[model samples]
Target: MSETHTSPVVLDVWCELQCPDCHQALEDIRALRARYGDRLEIRLRHFPLEKHKHSYAAAQAAEEAAEQGKGWGYAEAVLARTADLASHGEKVLLEVARELGLDAEEIDTALIDGRHTLTVDADHAEGKAIGVTGTPTYVIGDERLDGGQGQEGLRERVEEIADRLLAQG
Candidate 1:
């Protein structure tokens, strides 16, 4: 029987909000998706590190943005504003939300309510269970990748692996 390519290959990504590696990798992943289109399904999973004090809160903030239909946009904005975040504090999250047309007050309320903490915590625990150790870890089935691969590198790598996975049935 021949294999039918009916669905995208699941690309599980574990990342922290404040990790530079994660920020860079997110762009690469974006490129990967743009190039591959429906061939890949990249799921961003939170893995907030211990060192970045605001990483956990950033995760929740991103989730709150997700509730507002701008999760990735808010995340990308936050990542783009990483430098500002250090000086401006977590309020940078709400600023980014507003920049993305999301309501800062709603995000603030979500943060206060801890609306997405469990989701972030669950992702963190799942990442740890799967042997993820750092930000920007990409798991495609049993294969995993670390480091911040540039845009072309990541798209090419993911394209090659996704093709192989799809071909295998």
Candidate 2:
């Protein structure tokens, strides 16, 4: 009998773009992407901490980037420059949008119009409901790995969960 195809197992990664730890967690995300390829769907969920002044705007910008078909690219660029974001605020977000050849004006309008606020807010609310108190939290199936505690074995844990879920399919 032919095996039925199943949807890829989703790995929800709660992240704050201006978070240094989230930037560090990028390595693990890349590794997972490399390892699972299309078998795993790595989703970036916004969880802008209250401490990061520009995090909320950055999250909105990321949503706009997603609309422009450059979501991950924009996110990686912004995360790579967390320091700049901290120092320069929303300027860094616009800069990254322009650098990625995205519509900077549209992003600016989205920010001002608060178009993506609901999406970011919903993600934040859902994260809080799921016990996400920090950035880079990974949620696969019933497992929740907090990368803030230290990424020591976080990737492996996520891999184990993802592998098991894939096998169950």
What TM-score fits each model? 0.89, 0.98
lDDT of 2 by residue, 22-48 (tens): 999999999999999999998989999
Clashes of 2: 0
What would you estimate as the lDDT of candidate 2?
Answer: 0.95
lDDT of candidates 1 onward, in order? 0.80, 0.95
